[model samples]
Target: MRIVSVRTWALAVFGIVASYASLYWVQANTVDGITPPLVGNLPSIVIQGIGVAVMVYVVAQLGLRQPIGRQWAWLTAGSASFWIGSIVWAYYEVVLEQPVPFPGLPDLFYLALYPLAAIGLFSAVSAFGKLFDTRVPLALAAAVSAVATGAVYFAVFRTIAADAQLSAIEKIISFFYPLGDIWLLLFPAAALALTAGQLRGGRLAWPWWIVVLGYLMVAAADVMFTVGTWDDTYQSGSIIDTGWWLGFSAVAVAASLMLDVQRPRDTGEVAS
Candidate 1:
């Protein structure tokens, strides 16, 4: 099957984001009390559902027998976990007409997504283990990680950590999210940096970069969600959610383009 042009996918992604944003506005601004129950809960479910479908389809197309195939397979599972978490989120917000419980079942699935995807990423990076020159690449990664960790700590963890009203469990749950994103972010970044030489100006680079960008979107959305919730301004279908829709859509498109990124083009050293 022929994949569509990147521009086409980009347009489609933008269209989805626009649709989500529109739905969110409708949900937020109810007329005659019509939208608060139904429309309020649809955006996250719809966007995440599409992402999981794309991920599952991509893995199936790539075949599970191969190594990178297995990598995306796990990634698909991670996406599914997040999708399920959204369902639980919508269930409380729309179905039950109650506040969704924090540090709850949904939190379990949401937290699970990071480590699961991290496993997939770790698998992919492990494939290129021999190519790694531990000195320079490792040092660079560590330095960059230090900066990222510090930024996230100040921007996210610090607030959650200092929340006097939260229970010990609540604080722990809140802390888990940004830390999870840190885990998820490290993989694609490391893969890009480590494989840059082999991928030098190659077709494979873009998809990986897109994957990284998708996670950055997810990470950003997570931070925004945390702040919003901290300030009691967050709702499921808010504008901040556009980042998640865009992130998931971008990852799906990247997965579709993985025909090139599943492996390098010319280099034979990095096995699978």
Candidate 2:
């Protein structure tokens, strides 16, 4: 009756908890209304930061091999690029356009922090995927996520931002703003869950599948919401929209942690 290390288990548990807590904070503070203050939202951002850190530490210790490392590097580099774009968008959205409290430090921090975190997450995912020989699927998923995010940026976000009526230099950034975010939140979440299953030496845990399904569901919901709001101001119907994204993200993090806890320690060979 072997048991998992307490530290490993705790990291997984707290990572999920912190992720959800951050989501709740965003729901409570940011999505309820427009003109949300960046200063006020700092705590939630901090919580997310904590969760990402714990997740990186846990996955890094899981013993991934070299090929996976290279692929993960690509993912990390792409995510960082996406987040840099996001920081630019945020500056335009919060600091430039809307007057928010404590503008200077918070703005600068978020701008820098997102890309850094993206690199960390990419490292974690690469290491985690090394626990199994499922590189093809993992690579395919990363590619698809990248393509989808890119499509959204070029086709939808850029056009909307470029409109003369709504035009701002920041809007040009709208295209890539959420691209890294979608990849970071989706692929890494799924990768962690799959890694957990492989580490556990069990029949592939269904939680990974659930995470993918939830992502699809949330994506569908976003599409529906977009259609419904076509005639209305995009900002008005955002509470539910943002809440749904955060909720699914929390669920993904929690499920991944649970799977990680249930995984067994490595024998000499990788677990099938």
Candidate 3:
């Protein structure tokens, strides 16, 4: 770790502790007179606020100095977008004290995160070196996984399109979130592919996988929300919320560790 990383790490630790404590309180305290909004939903806003701020600090502290910097910039944008989504969602739950609508303003921001993150990730990794070495079959597996993810997206979309209760716009918007998240999983599924084989997986090297873990957390929550809500069975403050909280925390922590992550470029083999 770089000596300058102390502050960044401090902020990341705060986010983690805050999120964990908030989540622990929500889940462990089961008692009388407990509403889901107060006990389950409100804390998310607090977590998102801290999580996004930590990431913003990380990006701002580092600035856009290198390819990794550019990648983190986009990642920060992704986290900020999710933070906005959480705020909009909380406005409905905490401020208005009503059921948040599906396919609302929050959904728009939430859907944008995947593309922003994907573009940054692909751009940086591809610039570092060959993202997928044709010499290895892993690239082929990445291809297959991408295809499968796309197939699942279309299948789910078709089902949504057939639903009579939803409007035409709702049909498309409703599926976009889970669709984007399912795409998120593709990153970790082909983790080695993203390591940019040309650098001997040294471009992002270590923290990139942690970032992928963040994607996986959010993506797993996407699966939980999609399936659980199909029958209107999803509950607030459930284990699903932990995925998002932890996901955001992971991103902040990952960005803070960029100092060590970028060290490989100085001495080890690096692509120009």
lDDT of 2 by residue, 55-120 (tens): 344345433354333433333333233234334445645568653222233334333423653554
Deviation in angstroms for 269 in model 3? 24
Cα error, residue 104 of model 3, in Å, equals 0.7
Write the residue-wise lDDT of candidate 3 on 163-229 in tens digits: 6877767656656666566555344324434445346445444466667677678777876676555
| Stronger candidate by TM-score (1 vs 2) | 1
Off by over 4 Å in 1: 1-35, 132-135, 193-197, 260-272
lDDT of 1 by residue, 8-33 (tens): 36545653766567665765577654
Name the regions of candidate 3 deviating beyond 4 angstroms.
1-20, 28-34, 130-144, 147-171, 188-203, 263-272
**By lDDT, is 1 or 2 better?**
1
Better of 2 and 3 by lDDT: 3
Best by TM-score: 1
**Residue pairs in candidate 3 whose N, alpha carbon or C atoms collide under 3 angstroms:** none
The positional error of residue 103 in candidate 1, measured at the CA in angstroms, is: 1.0
Clashing pairs in 2: 200-263
Model 3, residue 21: C-alpha shift (Å): 3.2
